[model samples]
Target: MNQPITNAEKLSKLPWSIGSNALVNVFVQLTFLGSVFILFLNTLGLDKSQIGFLLSLVPYTGLIALFIAPLIARYGYKRTFVHFSVLRLLFAALLLLTPWVVSNFGAEATLLFITVVVTLFSITRSIVVTAYYPWAQEYIPKSIQGKYSATNNLFTTLAGFLAVTLAGFVLDLTTGLTGYLVLIIIGVLCGAVAVWGVTKVPGGAPVEVGRGVMASFRDTIAALGDKGLLFFLAGVGLITLATVPLTSFVPLFLQEEVGLSSGNVVLVQTGVLLGGLVSTYLWGWTSDRYGSRPIMLSGICLLALLPIFFMLMPRYSPVSLYVALGIAFLQGIADMGWVIGSTRSLFVSIVPPEKRSEYTALYFACVGVFGGTSQLLAGQVVQLSSGVSGSFYFFVVDAYTPLFLLSIIFAIASLFTLRTVRSDTQVTVEEFAGMFLRGNPLSAMTSLVGYHFAQDESRVVAMTERLGVTRSPFTVDELLEVLADPRFNVRFEAIISIARTRPDPRLTQALIDVFNGTELALSNIAAWALGRVGDQTAIEALRQGLNSKYHSIQANSARALGRLGDAKTAPLLLERLQNEPDIGLQMAYASALGNLRAKEATSPILHLLHDIQNEGARRELALALARLVGDEGHFIHLYREARADFGTATAQAVSAFKRKIEKVLNSETKVLSTLGACADNLARDQLTEGAGYLAQLIEVLPADHYDPH
Candidate 1:
């Protein structure tokens, strides 16, 4: 029999678990560097069509990347990232070569070459970026994906803020060739730094993918065949169509229409990026707490108002221009909903992990087409109207056009799509337990687990417990009906809830009897609940479970024993130290021993942890030993060594370890000591207080060897 899985193990692969903040750094740097080209386009003597042509190259290359993305997938993200980086740097350097080529050759020839360079860069950058996209789904945990990806976008937007402003400032200071060359040189340097960042991001095993490019492309498109995914892709396209015009051509609009100075215009432009950057986490938090659709719909409605606000910008005084920029900032914030909403959770949730990159490429490819076409159309429309300067009262209008109205229409249209984007708001196993503690209807408890509601049947069982009254509102037999429900999550949630809230010992015994036959997920939840409620009466049953041959069951029992705080099982736990073969189990063992405050098992833990296979477990075990021994030297040594190993895997691992150790040391030193001083003999009763210190120590040890008895 297998032991139950712990909460920590279940969420190990989530992006935040892998130090999602690193992505924020990546986004900020890329956006800042990427936006420079947009700011300086007109200064290079490029007309509207010419600038449009340059921007058009990004998608043109994206098309090529679309084809090669699968091939890159074959080699994996790590190699694709490295290759794309080298190409980007080379292309940045290639931009510096542009002026010399144009000076020597004809303008048309030079422009053609510049377009080629942009296209190639765009293609390679696509592979680099898209390759990394799958990792977002792979690395981040499901619970926090929305928040982490949104925060990542927020940081990326800040880069846009600085890039737009500085690009304007640079162009404002230097002449045509000199400014362009300088921006390109800076771009190369940024690209080099970006390369370093990607290399540092640790990679896991590559997913099995289609062997060839065409087959991968086929699979990518096939992913959209899922109705949910199809709507998501459509939503992405519509959102991009609505927003790309604002980002790509807004600089030109601000300059020519508002008649603002270049420096001042850049500041106004910052409104969009800053607003976006500030609002990302809010939208993400909302999505996590609520659902993606409501937040997304709100953003779209807000975006629909941008055209109305644009009409007022020309009427405002210079000081009031700040107000206008503020509106632009609002537009940017609304735009954050689209970017954050479209890219991550919905995409990953609808598709399997193996096919994420392929599906993501299809989504972005459609985005490139729609986004690219909108920018080209906006530019052309502006170019045709550039010559029609109408004097409105005393004000001069350079390009007063109705094109922004199209943007407004697109945004409004997006609201209709929200109705189809459904996710459920249901209580989780954790919340179900909390509900019992309060003695209320669990159904009334607000939850974000609705996304998994339709997929699981046990939810009904859990709901029954939440709704059940002491008078037996529903028959006891109706509760047992939940076990037969085929949906795993539902069964899992129901069994756990029943075990927690129901007082019948026989019911618990029956639940425990059938627990072994349940799915790993549901079984783990049952085990966890059984342990949490301190069902000492079921200790004999739990002890029987510990004797099971299954690794998962054994591990769960180890954890349950710790939670039970039974010194009687200390020897059982200690005996297993030399028998378990799994590193993850060893970590659980260290954690369990620490939880029990089994000071008797300390030397065994310290000795076994020394030869641990996993660095994370070893680090945790060392800290546990320190707690058991009550030595400041152990704390210092653990802190110093763990910090040194922080960069190897996920920075989050290092941070998690540091936080655990510090929390333990701090609590033990302050709160616990004060209580111990006051309680005197009463201090011994606070077993968990000491257990807390040991728990941290055990959790911090390296997980090299786990031997289950």
Candidate 2:
């Protein structure tokens, strides 16, 4: 039997609400660096071959960073942020130092310069990212983490647009050594700023603290235990690999084959960036509001179209460049979708919170391994094609054929991973009621087992609600066993029923195991259950869903987490609140937080209220916030503040409640005319009509407010 819900359940939810800010900072840094990458690369003297080789080195170096993510998890995000900033600073400094190092050492220093530059950038990028990735997983509510991740990416994309334009102008102003020096200086300054920005944001407590680096590594590797994650990585890897050919060589092809000018090349790149900026945010917002799977599938299907479009570019004009840009935009959407779908939140929800860092690090390691090989192979293909004689266009297109075909195959495979499973494993309805009423939880559990054997899934779900009134031990076992039932329907019914009743660790584990397939019913229910559970174990699973390719799953998850309530989740909620344009989701989040008594959620909640055009929702939220506080003094203060301002539904409720309390406590009471009039105004809305009754009782109540407002 599970323990009864308590104050601590609500408190744990608070942390999730607060730690999302750190992730926003990290994503912003990603955009800032990406925008300036080409400008920085141009400043180097390496030939085409050297540049390709040097670029390939980036992933290998990144692999090292991925390797150490466990250590960062052990030490805490605070230290991770420190490591990230220091490494980035070093990388930025190296960019400026590269020219001098080359000048001093001559030809002998060329390889060394490339190595140092790539090494520095790689290390900084990976370490910061490793630390940053888990921030969302650790803090943000699973329900909305997708949206938060997407919105954060959207902000980063906006930053990219601004940063690229500025970097381009800066590099354009000067020539040769002076120009390079200026770029290096700016890079250093920006890197430092990024680090500073991240450190300023508060982070969640490190779940895996003070472990040895090796132990951390072991944990990260252990994340592969989840079959869904393993397959998801494989599918995502193929997609990334498919993209490498275009992402790497598109610029060079445009410059050489199309005979375009440097300015035009910049324009093309800018166009691509703009596409990414728009698409990433758009998809992210949608993913957060909906779910990750649908969004992911949509993006993948669109990606298949890119290659076919690229093949048509041979006979096309500058308009074809637009087509290419559109394709890049679609690619950006897919990338964002992939990020959400593959979030560590998904893993965390399935696995225990104690294992989150280990899983995250392992996931990143897989990304690096697959992503690096793809880059190398892509570079080799491009290099080989460049040496071949006839029409470079056909040769390059042919080289990419395998990748495109593979992406299509994996995309189809991803559909299989889209099935939804139940949120937790628990007993059915009749069993629960029987257990509580008869004081025989085992009998109640047996009833559920009998129901499962009979395959009465619908009745099972119906009965689970009745079971929720009590928390019994045998009920937990019944629930766990139900999830392992041979029949899919039986397991699905059992999982969802448990989610509605209470969270079970076994249920969490089973969901991870069964997270594959195209049926989203189970997954959606499970997501909702995890959100309600409000434990660290479910964080990664929820985080992964934030960028879920499906809008529905993403939205439901966000809404669920908002209700779960944790301080760690506040910052992430705020990030989504700031960036997403979905009105419905915004309302759901406000309501969920209110119901969860998310005290620390005030800032973000208040911020959302400022722009809310919906009067009804705003008023409801105001009242809900008061209810959430559940403190007499605070409630009375809220009542007084609203009452003094003017006539509104909220004011009437406060006034009426005030009167009712006063009359009950004091024999002789006095009626407040303003409160009476307010109650009359409130009676028009059915939702607030109850306020009228309280208004009549205000005449005799005592002055002191009740605690359970």
Candidate 3:
């Protein structure tokens, strides 16, 4: 369910989607896949491996949708989803009869009944899930996919929290089959509500899908072979392989190794839900504005740490409970980041819009396959490592230790695959982590979440100013959003604030796009922002900007190109300055030429210096000549002193610089000697010792030339 702030229609339906998600999670978190389900099964004399098989079977059974997708696509994903969701709900209700089946049929027969019931339910649910993605993809607007996912997660996680808490209380009060039966009834009721909510949202009509089943198969084949898509899937698969085990076994590890009571373990597990609730919006917002790859990488990194933490966690103590809760909270954050990033990245980064159905099928199937295999693999490890008790340098090892070790290894491998997966984002995982590490993490999260609260111009300006003041890379998303605000003053301030952060491709491109805009003020400031960012990618755009009709735009573009040091445009600057009639614009072009150290520009600037009537403009041309010939300090001193007293050390420095220009024009025999002199003069500035002063002069503009006040 997408709740795009600007889309009124989508906003109106947001509650239905969120409510539906909450209901579904309530059902899920109580009966079938929830902790209550596992505990109930365990009390029935089922072993861990058998429990893992049942849990793993849910995702594994999703493979049935692969062959039936064309039918689902032809019949309409929404209609099929709603129809099957109802059927699945009915099947979920049958679990209420499990106690009777056990009493009548004996233990062997009971497992068969449960298995058959769950298998059928899983098949129908798989169809609903597989069809749901393309439908959801069509239903949700692309811009808010991350927000939509995160927001839905928030509601669903909250509902799950209540459902799990209820189940915990019910089981505590009523033991054996009666407690599970009550839980199943509640789950069934929640499922009914979930099914009702799904009908409220629009768009799930049948698409004009491929004609044959072979079409989906062909697409799947192509997806598996395509290097880029395949590599991304590989990354996703490795990550899935790494993380599925943690959710499956970590609770068991806490109970067995950490010496937490079953009741305390449930409370400890609430931390995961809390963590997810806290981070849901922030991760979604970040992914939507930024990209999902970094979030995914960050999730992997966080998951990679848990194994070590688990190993070092003190056992059988009050502190162990808190420690386990802290680790579970981190796991919750990792879970949100992983799911939101991986799933959203599928649509935005991996899949083509037209091929959403085709790609979504492959994406889910990849996760399903890896997810199923990971469960079985993790179960085998846990079983095999049952005798793995030992101690190594303060770290405790147990049957659960191998699962943690495997998780760590798989997480590390997933990172390498992440690096290979091509993404449009230029930011590395390290940079994204560093943003939080270096800046105020709490401030960054609060500002990002509150970004949309700025409804009026005043609030918008205040938020934009905060972003600029914080100067964190984490604030770049808000800055990008603000840069597009309809309010002129808001956009203006955003550009200025963007100048304060490190140069980013997204920010650089936004500035370049604004630079090419028709708005006079915005385009001018955009030019200045690009110069401040100093990204070479904007050089061509700035060069195009030099042709703008507004004098301010032209001057700012010329100066920006100089700041960017696009030396290729120095000759162009010289030509524009030579033909320019505007005094201020001439000064700007001269400044650019000077900054570029255009040796040929030295002679032309010297020739134009005497003809310039305004004393300020004349001195500007002389300064340009000084820079072009590699004399910065002297010209700066002379340019300032000439207003008070022209004949002194300042005069001598100006004269010496002028003598080099004289050789370039009139003395052919001394041209090489003067060239040597210019080279020698420029050498001192090779590391740009006086470059700051030069920049100071260019940025200020000739106040006498432009500002009447």
lDDT of each: 0.61, 0.56, 0.78
TM-scores, each model vs. reference: 0.55, 0.51, 0.71
Count of clashes in candidate 3: 1
> What order do candidates take by TM-score, descending?
3, 1, 2
Q: Tell me model 2's lDDT, rounded to 2 decimals.
A: 0.56
Ranking of all predicted structures according to lDDT, beginning with the best and ending with the worst: 3, 1, 2
- On residues 644-683, what C-alpha lDDT tens digit does candidate 2 reach at each position? 5544546555566657745654534344453455466554
Global lDDT of model 1:
0.61
lDDT agreement of model 3 with the native: 0.78
* Residues 680-699 of candidate 1: C-alpha lDDT, one tens digit per residue: 32234444444454455445
Residue 155, candidate 1: Cα error in Å is: 3.1
lDDT for 122 (candidate 1): 75
lDDT of 3 at 102: 82
Worst ten in a row by lDDT for model 3:
700-709
Error at 119, model 3, angstroms: 1.8
Q: Which candidate do you rate higher for lDDT, 1 or 3?
A: 3
Clashing pairs in 3: 76-206
